[model samples]
Target: MENSHASPGLLKQANSSALHRALREKGAATRAQLAAATGVSVTTVRALLEEMLRDGEVERTGLGASSGGRRAAQYSLRRDKYYGAAVCITDGQAHGLLVDVHGEIVRAVPLKAGADGLRTPVLAFLDGLFAQRDIRSIGLGLPGVVREGCFWHADKEGGLHSVAVEPALSRRYGVPVVLENDVNAAAIGFARCYETEFPGEDPAETNMAYLHFDRGCVSAGFVAGGRVIRGCGHFAGELGLVPTADGRLLDECLNDPQDGREYTARVLEAAVWVCGILNPRYIALGGPALRRECIGPVNDGLSALLPGPMCPELLYTADIWGDYQIGMAWLTAEKIFHMVQIIKK
Candidate 1:
C-alpha cells in the first residue's frame, strides 16, 4: 500500500501552516529562524516563503543581524491580508471588533440591545462591521452553554437558549464561526495576555482561571495547558449552581447578599473552591457587577484560608468585555489562517 498518512499537498499545507504560525508569533523571522522554529528544512522554508511572498501573505521587512557573514532576509505576516470579526454580549450591549491577523483591533463599535436576547443586536453589529470591511471568520462570546455550533442552554432569563448560533451565522455570512462561553473566552484572553507580557513562558504550560459575576449569575473558567476545560456537559463554569454552606445555592447567596461583607464572603467561597481544584497561577475577578473593592478582600480571604503556596494572585479588571473581544479575535483569526490557501505558481 502507498504511504497514505498524508499526501504531498497535505504535507506542504502543514508545513506552510507551521511557517505561518511561527511568523505570527515571532512577528518576523528569517528563513533559517523559521526553519528552526517550525522544524522544517531550510530549503523547504525558502520555497514556502517565496510562495507566501508572491501571494502577498507575507512581506519582506528588511534583513536580520548577521551572525558571521551576510544577514538573512526577514519576513512577516501581512497584517492586512484578512480581517476577523469578534463580538461579546454584556451589560445590555453588543461590542464588535474588527481585527487583523495579529489580533490587533482595527475598529470597534457598540450597539445597545436587550441583555436577555442578543442575537439580533449582535447580527446588527456584525452587519455594520461587514459594511466597513470584509470579514473572513467570526468569534462570539456568549453567556451560556454552547456545544457543537449550538447554544444549548442559558440562564433562566437568557433568551439565547436552543439557538443554532454557529451554523446560522456561518451560513448567513459564509465564514467559519467559533462560539465560546463568555467566561471561557475571557480566561483565554487573560492567559494569552500573560503569555505576551512574559515572553519565553508558554501559556500551554501555565494554569489560569477567571471568575465572573454578572446578570444574576456566577461563572468561572479554567485554562489548563492553554485550553479551556469545558466539562462533559459544557457546564463546567456554571459556578452559580454550586451549593453554599448556608443551605442555599451559591448564586442565590451571591445575588441576594445582605451587605458588602456577605457578598465578599460569598465570592470568597467560590474563589476558594477554584483554588482547591485548579490552583491556578492567577485568578481574575471580572464582570460588570464585580466591585473593584472586592478584589482586596477576596485576595485576603483566600490567603487566610489557603496556605502561602496554594494561594494564587488575585486581581480585578474592569475591561472584561475587552478581554472577550481579544479572545474572540484570536480564535477567529486561527480559523481564517487555516483556510487561507497558498497556491504555488
Candidate 2:
C-alpha cells in the first residue's frame, strides 16, 4: 500500500507518524514496545522519541513495569501540544469543532446553512477557533464525493459541487487541508469511538461497514484494516443510486412506512451483498429514521435474509453527527503530524 503521489520527504515524516500513532493507540509505551508496534528499529524509535520529547510532541510518562531486568521509560503523546479544527457540512447546517491532539473535542458549534453557502460560515468558524489556539490543520467532511480536495454531488441545496475545498482552505490557513466524504468520515469516527469505548477490541484488525440512511438517501463507508476504502474514483459507498425492488430507486422507499418491509428488505439485501463482497465483522446503521425501535426488526430481517454463516452483527450509531466531528478531528491531527499534503486532481 504505497502512495505513489507521496513525496520521499512526506514518506519520511510518515515514520514519525507511525510511531506517534502507536504511542497514541497504546496510550503509553516503552521504546521497545513502540519499535515492535511500529515495525521500526529500536534505535530509530529512540531517536524519534528524543526528537518528539524535545519538540513537545511526546513526553516521558513514567517507567514501565520491571521485566525481570530494567524498567523501561514509558512515553506518551503530549495531547495538549497542538490543536486542529474540523468542519462537517450537512444539508441544513455546518458543524465545527476544535480538537486537541488527543482526539478530544475542546469546543463545538453549529452554523446554519445560509444563502451565501457553507464555505463562508465554515471559514469564519474555523478562523475564530484558530485564533484561540495553535491549529496545525483543518479537516472538512463534506456531504458529497470528495476527490483530491474537490467537492461534488453534494446535497441538492448545499451548493457544494465541484468546489475547490482543500485549496481554498489550505491557502487561507497556510496549512494542510483534508477533505473527506461525510459518511466515510463518520465511519472513521465511529471506529475510533468504538475502539476508545472498548479498548480491548482492535477495530483496526477487523472489517467494518458503516451504513447511513439519511433523508431518503443511503450511503455506506467501508473500513478494512483500519483504512477507509475510497475506491478508484473515491465513490465507494454511493448506495442511494442503487435500485430497489419494484424498480424504484432506494431513496424512493425511504419515506414510505407502508413499504417498510420492502425498504428494510432491500437494505438487508444490500447488507448481505456487502457481507459477501467485503465479509465485514460488523455493520453499523445510522440516521434519524433508523431509530432504536427499528433495530430489532432490522436485525430480525437481516437474520432472515442472511444465512447463519453469512450473518454479521448489526448495530446502530445514534450520534453519527458526533462521529463525523471526531473523524474530522482525527484526520486533521493526521495531516498535522504526518505532513499529509493535499493532492490536486
| Model 1 bad stretches (over 4 Å) | 1-4, 114-121, 124-134, 154-161, 339-345
What's each prediction's TM-score? Answer: 0.89, 0.86
Candidate with best TM-score:
1
lDDT, model 2? 0.80
Q: TM-score of model 2 relative to the true fold?
A: 0.86
Candidate 1, residues 148-189, lDDT tens digits: the string is 888776456865467788888988899878898877888888
Model 2 off-target regions past 4 Å?
Answer: 1-15, 113-115, 154-161, 257-260, 339-345
lDDT of each: 0.81, 0.80
Q: Against the true structure, whose lDDT is highest?
A: 1
lDDT of 2 by residue, 1-345 (tens): 123355767655766878877875678999999989877789888888899899988988889999799899999988788888988887667888888777778888888765787767877888887788888879888887899789887565766568787898888899878899989989999888877787887765857899998877788999998789999999898777777767877776665675556566767767777888878778899887664555677778767777887678888898888888888888877766653332436
* Window of ten residues with lowest summed lDDT in model 2: 336-345
Q: Give lDDT for model 1.
A: 0.81
